[model samples]
Target: MLDDNLRASRQTAHDRPDLQISFEFFPPKTDVMEEKFWDTVHRLAPLKPRFVSVTYGAGGSTRERTLRMVRRIKAETGVDAAAHLTCVGASRAEVDDVVRGYREAGINRIVAVRGDPPEGVGKPFVPHPEGYRNAIELVEGIRRIGDFDISVSAYPERHPQSPDWNNEIDNLKRKIDAGATRALTQMFFSNSDYLRYLDRARAAGITAPIVPGIQPIHSFRQIASFAARCGTAIPGWLAERFDGLDNDPETHALVAAAVAAEQVTELVDEGVTEFHIYTHNRSPLALALGRILGRRHEVAAVDAA
Candidate 1:
């Protein structure tokens, strides 16, 4: 079984030169965390990702940190960096200012999301009295500010607040019509969910690229909690794979690499060429997954030579 997986990985490495990948990161809060974040960035930057994005906090809580990180990433690593913009606690003017800031810094890629309520996820999201109402409005607002390459969020399992499929896909369409060039999905453990959502989006006449969000589980407990909050289902088999490994870090890490590799390998077979990875500010698992998908660290190779 292991040999078969290795052969498949080698085959993918040889055949898929068109595979494109991007990484998502969050701003570090403490000095210790900041050191770790930069290390992760420097490590992964050599993979030549399409882009690396810094996430905004709920209600623009990490606004300044996010902006600062992206700027430094672009300057120091020469990687195209994207900033996340959200309409939650801020008004339209405030959000627009953030967009302008990114433009002035020469960072033009924006991930427009109608962020969770300041209260928290699963709570009712109340847009500010003077703010853009939803993601569609946010996308429009960003478009008016600059000719930024915009990306919006998509949900394969349906948004927790969405009533049905039509409402969900309609909202996504409205965002695209507003100027978003791409849609990145929320992470899902089941590939079928993502493929079915892609089919539905195509059938609905949404033509933008819908990139699947792949998350390598650094910690199953934490990821499971996030899945529960975001309406992503955790299949029983996935749970069984991680079962009884809490105290066994060595074995747990191996399982994590194999599981995530299997997920992306299957997606590649299904004709999905682009991926957005949620890195959670760690490099080891994400690096392992990238290598499985045939990404090589260019700088490391040069140094070794």
Candidate 2:
């Protein structure tokens, strides 16, 4: 049961009605996974997000699949779709072709990123000889292709490859100069980290919107492993919350919801009105967060394409 304080806070969130949201999804690799992916999409479509994004695989390995999923989401559900474009292994021409394709398809939003090295997160990143060297260059290249509302990545805890927080902030400013309209942070457990980063970003003269990325933890162990790779620190207290609950799925889900609700509500109090959720192609927890944010409404009828 929720405490009275939190229950009242949840009610306050439910009454606001003006919060904006977006969700991210990865392309499904198999038929069964595809079914599950659409189920997640259908369940959340009615909240009417700002735009939903489809993630690109490392080194553009899933380029075709990402484009297909983005297009399908737009055509079938009428929801605005943002395709993630990454600079990793592809040449400038190849990347340009993809950007032009998105323009022709009427998908105008892009999340430009300097993606993980093809080998994986912990490995050294080697840029393709003929490709853009980083996200800043990729953002410029996409701008050259067409008019796009571009978003780039921001690191609250600093990117794994960054030498320091200042370097990461400098890199983000460069991406903004290259035409990105917004920056979405890497997932962070502590709100203070994000608030500090925002202060530094403002001090550095970056005027674009820096959106926080929220991940609803479905599995603590799995997310902990991911945090290790992505440079996000898991607070010791958070780990304590999940302690000894490995076998308790129901309790785990409740705990996850409560933790996320607290995180979001606290951020909202700090004057944040827009959020980007990394859904990981699942729905229940994401939907719960939306409802907790006062986005509850009737479901829209959407047919999968």
Candidate 3:
């Protein structure tokens, strides 16, 4: 089975070369982390991403910072910036204000999300009394404020709170009807799962581009924990790849790049041309994976050199 996967990866390595990629980033909370975040931005901006996004924190925790970062990215970088707008804690008016601010700052894109609960993942999400009720509503509200290229979230494995995939697809339809031009999926390891979800979405009349979210493993344990909370499944083979490299950063990074390269290569072979990379304020791994998927580097040759 492993050999078959490797053969497929090699076949893909020799074939597909065109890819349109975007990246996601979260706002930094400290001075040192801020420095690292800018370094990441500088390193990745050269790749010419479709657009780089800044994540809005749970319950609007990083609202100001998200805006500041998005504004700065648009002003300082050549890449287009997309701001994440959510209805977790802010009212409709507040969220609208943020949307207008993005327009004024020349940020013409947004990722509309319902966002996580204030208490954290797994906690019940109670919407603010005067806020938009959900992501679909937020999409509508953003539309009312300005003409922005809105992208809403999609869950390939079904959202944790959703009863089933059918219901999730219906919810996505509503978001599209509300004026979202694109749907970016939650992170999932299996390409087959994304393909199946895409089939279902198309069957349900969703014709917009559904970009798969690709998360390069910075720390297997950390990603596993997040996957557990967000209902993202980590395949056993993936876990096996990172099994005991927790303490060896060197080997860990090598394995991470390899795993991510294989994943993206297989996806590319399957005809997926667009990807969203979740860069957790780190660069080396995501940068490596980007170069690999674009066939800009030879993995073994880089390792050998």
Candidate 4:
């Protein structure tokens, strides 16, 4: 009965107008990776993600690579590009230069963040003192430099550094009040984590679309390591799903696709119309999920939007 009511609720929600979906990607670290990255780009471009983002790397380490990919997307792809800007290791002037470059390149969307400190996640964060203090500060600074559409990070399970969940919620409120138009959560595993986070967000009076971040898991070890750093809790059932497949790459791929497909389909069933995927530059997984979701993108539709 609840499933029926929930399904009916989604049908009603669908009538309310769907919010756009987008994805985030990291710049390739090698030549072979570069080829794979663009192949993924070409494959997903047809999906008409509202915008696709390139991740800003450690202490600005991936700055050049990320810039190269983002500019290329703006030049060659059918999708809008969002550049990630972070506050770790970069001063105001340094960040300003990057932001100005993106503007000149005709890219207008940004995912502003207080990036992980150069040391790494779980390490203490030392603000540049001169750089932005947090994501809110970064958003304000970006708004001042150029009229860019800025998005910030949201942690559905609470960020690693937050003293409390309310602190996390309050931080998000500050980001919104400071002008972030949307919030993309760090990648998560549980659908329930996302739904409950959204509910708490609304109750806290934060009205922006807190788009659930979906990471298509290709390797159990890698994803688990990532979830640990990012504060995403992997349920016991998920761990069980990947338990015995450590040595089987082919079966792992099949299982990975199935799990991601189920995640998104369930979210779609639960009334979540917008998605932001952390694609890690592997399009096959994201593509498999898209096809399962019935995405048959028409060029005419993309051009018209």
Candidate 5:
């Protein structure tokens, strides 16, 4: 009887036909990367994502490239572009000027973050003396500069350098209070972790829409290294799914698509209607997953060419 009830509940959650997805891309560092980035954008923008975000690099080193990509997307694509702005090493005046620059470029959304330092993750964070103190401070500054829509990050297993889980949640609340309108969690493997985080956020009076960030694990070695750096644990079972297929690229791609599609299906069963996919400037996997979930690509039908 309990099993039957649980099945019914899952079906009820997945029955909702309306769903939304967004994507995140990094600033291209070179000509070849730039071509890949734009082609990925062209391929996936047809799905009409809620908003496509371009990430500013650590210490804002990719600031100009990010802004250029964002402005071009705003001008050429049908999707809204959210420019990421980080508070790590820049002064308040410098950050403010960047905000104004976005406004002048006709971009109106910001993904505010307290970015990692040159020392990278697992290192202590030292706030810049003249910069905005944190992501919350940066969000507030954006609000003062313009009527921009702001989004902030949420950590499910807690940030690596955070003192405790409470401190992490408190920091999220502070960002929302400052001016953030939505939250996107760090990439996680299990649905239960995201659900529990949502439960705790509700308990703490957080009501903003929280989008789960999804990464399609395509390469085992690369993903494992990235998981270690971001503090996201890779379950043994998950690793086993791709085991022994390392020598077979075709089999690996098929396995990757199946696994990613299954993850999103399970998330939908858990009442998750929104997703944010990290596209490492490659969209075939994401595009395939979207088609699997019944999202239609609308690009060629409405093109000027």
Candidate 6:
């Protein structure tokens, strides 16, 4: 049922052992959600990701929860955890204090972002009168506080606010120049978009790793809605694949796995060796993706040996 080229690509990915992965999670708002969050974390921990990151909510609404979750994850799981820091609604001193908190907590890795305006994505981002103005300033502020391994956001398709590729790539360059060690792109459905963005970034002299962010289609409808909100284009073909399967959970799950499999394998074939998965606090699809990327549970492998 598979074409030879795609099948060979899958095999090549499985055989190559150099691939690296990371996961993103958000702070749980409720007790029930907290239980599910840990379940997801434990389920995917065996894959031994390079690091796991917890997101800070808009306007730092979940700041305390984000810090608590990241600390617990590192302390309990022994996995290096990164915290997301943003410049949306906090003054410079306040933001710097949070950075100090992360340093004190031993969270040395940070995902520095100019987060969505408190109003929401696509809304105008007005900096706090006394806060870091953008991601560049946020990265600089984080750098001043500690020697953090900072990561910033990139957009495969230009960000909604960026008027052109020049502006987009330049912004990325500035972020990296400030202190960011890596760039993690926004979730994109098209590999070509990512590849092209990479080429442009390279052309502009960005030498740091621009890791692709992979989003598993946990729910097609929900993901589509997110894509729309974030300005990510959904290909017609992708839409057609999920088209009449809204009520069929089983089939939808199968198709979701297949779609994500094809996407990552193709990237692997194109020489992409690093990935950052947005795990919306779920495990089945992320676990399936780990297997497809040739990662196995360390304990299971050791026991088998």
Q: Write the per-residue lDDT of candidate 3 for residues 1-305, one digit (tens) a residue.
A: 56986777556433565678899999999999999999999888877788999999988889889989988887787789999988998889988888888888888999999998888887888989999989999998999988899999999999999998879999999999999999999999988999999999999999999999998999998999999999999999999989988999899988888888878877887888889999998989778767766624323435544
Clash pairs detected, candidate 6: none
Tell me the deviation in Å of residue 212 in model 1. 0.5
**Model 2 error, position 277 (Å):** 0.3
The CA lDDT of each predicted structure is 0.93, 0.91, 0.89, 0.84, 0.87, 0.93
Q: Which pairs clash in model 2? A: none
Tens digits of lDDT, candidate 5, 68-92: 9998887788689999999888999
Per-residue CA lDDT of candidate 1, range 158-201, in tens? 99999999999999999999999999999999999999999999
- Cα deviation in Å at residue 33, candidate 5? 1.2
Selected candidate, larger TM-score, 2 vs 3: 2
Which regions in candidate 1 have their CA more than 4 angstroms from the true location? 1-10, 299-305
Query: How does residue 280 of candidate 5 score in lDDT?
Result: 89
Residue 43, candidate 2: how far off, in angstroms? Answer: 0.6
Decreasing lDDT order of the candidates: 6, 1, 2, 3, 5, 4
TM-score of 3: 0.91
How much is the lDDT of residue 89 in candidate 4?
A: 89
Candidate 6 lDDT score at position 106: 86
Candidate 4 clashing pairs, residues 3+ apart or interchain: none
Clashes of 6: 0
Q: With candidate 1 superimposed using the best TM-score fit, by how many Å does residue 36's alpha carbon deviate from the native?
A: 0.5
- Show pairs that collide, candidate 1: none
| Candidate structures ordered by TM-score, highest first | 6, 1, 2, 5, 3, 4
lDDT of 2 by residue, 1-305 (tens): 99987776555666667788999999999999999999998888888889999999998988889999999998888889999999888899989999998998888999999898878887888889999999999999998988899999999999888898878889999999999999998999999999999999999999999999999999999999999988899999999999988999999999999999989999987778889999999999999989888886585789998
Stretches > 4 Å off in candidate 3:
1-17, 295-305
RMSD of each: 3.1, 4.4, 4.6, 4.2, 3.2, 2.9
